[model samples]
Target: MAYRETVKIRDRKAAQREALLAAAEGLVREGGFAALTIQALSARAGVGVGTVYRYFRAKDTLAAEVFRLATEREVAAVAEALQHQTDAAAKLEQAASRFARRALRAPRLAWALIAEPVDPAVDTERLRYRAAYAALFEQMIEAGVRAGELPLQSPTLSAAALVGALAEALVGPLADHQADEHVVQQLIRFCLRAVGAADPTAPEVSHEQVC
Candidate 1:
């Protein structure tokens, strides 16, 4: 007869894996992927280093997993923001603001996700997620063009450019932890102009309202 794992054993294993992942995420949040070593994860999770190995066969795999988990949340946020607004221009502006605001809110983690030097595996994930963001922007840009809300442009190129621009603009400020509402507001205006949308009537968004 073949041996089988019981329900209790499977549940316990799942819980342990989640705990390890949560601890790994916490370490990345506080100090970036540079701080996420198997031994460090063991200490944080209060498990043996060998246990971390059980969940993640290698360090690169672990780093990539953490990157994917954190970046998915950010992408979802921008997508959600886009959905909430009525027009293509408003959706673009709101999505840009939401992304910038969230990055400012978590500068350290944002820096890690945006520009940290890590293994090749993690870099691959970064490129994939950047494309994910661009895809979201591409849809909106295409809609705006069709609706006559935006000037004629190549949505693919424009969307990719917006992702690159937003990342580059925030890298310096995010690294220094100086990003704020002003930066977010500027980003919104920049994205609007880049996409040929109307400028925001308000000089700046109220920090009180945005944050």
Candidate 2:
């Protein structure tokens, strides 16, 4: 009986934590990270301030979790989008387009995940996730070189540069809330040209799609 009761209590606590995180994310989306507060979050989440504190001791902790969750979703989406695409150039273009579409769909979440100041621990985790995504670009670049689609050179540097350029081009305007479909298409074209791909057009990845 005690074990069952403990399990139930644990489940309830987990649910409450999820609720608080969801509320915090919504608040950040509506405003910005500056608007996230324990009291505000507690009210938004329909939980007491003490309950919010139980889940997250500080605003920074909650903010970190929000970014972590958003980044994790992005990593998953990118991986999933690239999974079935076999061609190197196609994979790269698809990944870039999908990423842009996802960012456009969740502008606020994108800004919070990429532009907001986060704790060191969260930043380290984000870097690891980013590196994992970069590895896909590295693999695609190497494949392009091996297939003679691209010149045989430093694949790692080239991949890193391409990824960095695409990110910089796409994310700045997005963080500024000025990103649109046309801007995303232009960024995709730029990335494709930088990669030396034959085609610079992004195949129709829907805006609703998460990458």
Candidate 3:
């Protein structure tokens, strides 16, 4: 009986932690990290501030967790896009289009993930996820080169540049709350051109289908 009770307590604590994290992510989705205070999180989660502290020792810790959670979802979406298409160029296009469409769908969250001034912890997470994106692109670029879809070039550098281009291109528009398919198409074309892919025609990504 004691062992069963212990298991239940552990499960309950885990659920509570997940709830707090979910609330933290919601706050960021609506207002960015600046709005993710412990008090605010507790209020949103219907818990005491001390309860929040019990899960996360500091605001920076909490903010970093939120960043990690949000970035992982973004990365996974792009990864799925890359995996869905067989052609290397097509994979790159799909991944880029997916990223841009998702960003346009949630500009506030995108800005927070991309360019918002944040705590050191959150910034560290941002850099790590940037590398994660570059790694994904690098694999596609290498495959393109292998398949003769792209010219001979350094995949690592090209991948980093592509990631930078996508993020930088969206910064101004995302900040301004502008949702334009033209922008996403341009971004896809730009990435293909930069990688020296032939016939770089970018397909339209619908704002309605942004996931």
Candidate 4:
């Protein structure tokens, strides 16, 4: 007889893999990335230590996978939020707002993904995801410039600046804890000004709306 796979066995294996990843994510959420070890992850997932190795070879690999998964999900969400908006400035506003809202709501996860010092392997993964985020802004900036909605500037550079500004502002102790609404607004306004996006809501010469 030829070798064949059973649906039941494949489903069970898939479920176990998901469980392991979930446990890794939970550990990072609760205690940051350093807390995710093979023994600790096995305990958290209610699986044997060997089982974790079956799914992932090392802690850094697992941690990097978790970061990729989370960031990919956020990318999809921001993309969806930007579907209805036509103007580049409005698209930038909505996209930045969506990213800021999620980061502010989950500060610990945000911190780990944004600025937590980790293995160089994981750092490489972080840079990849950050580039993914910058691409979103770059696309919007290009559209804006073609439409004459924004001044002529290097979209790639502007995108990188916006990504850095947003991540730093939300991640470290540099952030304020009160009034998420106010903070999100400030971040959006900064993004518009940085891109020279000409929106009616953008404060040109006022100190009040700048904050």
Candidate 4 local lDDT, 1-211, one digit each (tens):
1234577777889998988888888888777787878999999988898989998998889988988888888888998988979999889889988998887777677778888789888899899988998998899898888889999999899989999998888764423345277888888887888898765565463786576
The alpha-carbon lDDT assigned to residue 55 of candidate 4 equals 85
Candidate 3 residue lDDT tens string, 121-151: 9999999999999999999999889988889
Pairs of colliding residues, candidate 2: none
Clashes of 4: 0
In angstroms, how far off is 89's CA in candidate 2?
1.1
The candidate maximizing TM-score is 3
Off by over 4 Å in 3: 200-211
* Whole-model lDDT values for every prediction: 0.88, 0.77, 0.90, 0.83
- Give the alpha carbon lDDT tens digit for every residue of 1-211 in model 2: 9999999999999998888888888998877677788989988988789988888988878877887786778878887888877777777778888888888888876766665676675677667766876787898889888998876768888777876776667668877888898877676766766777755343454444322
Worst 10 residues of 2 by lDDT: 202-211
Candidate order, lDDT descending? 3, 1, 4, 2
- Candidates 1 and 3, the one with greater lDDT: 3
Candidate 1 has which clashing residue pairs, if any?
none
- Model 4, stretches more than 4 Å misplaced? 1-5, 173-179, 200-205
Q: For all candidates, what are the clash counts? A: 0, 0, 0, 0
Error of 4 at 128 (Å): 0.9
lDDT of 2: 0.77
Q: Per-candidate TM vs. native? A: 0.92, 0.85, 0.93, 0.91
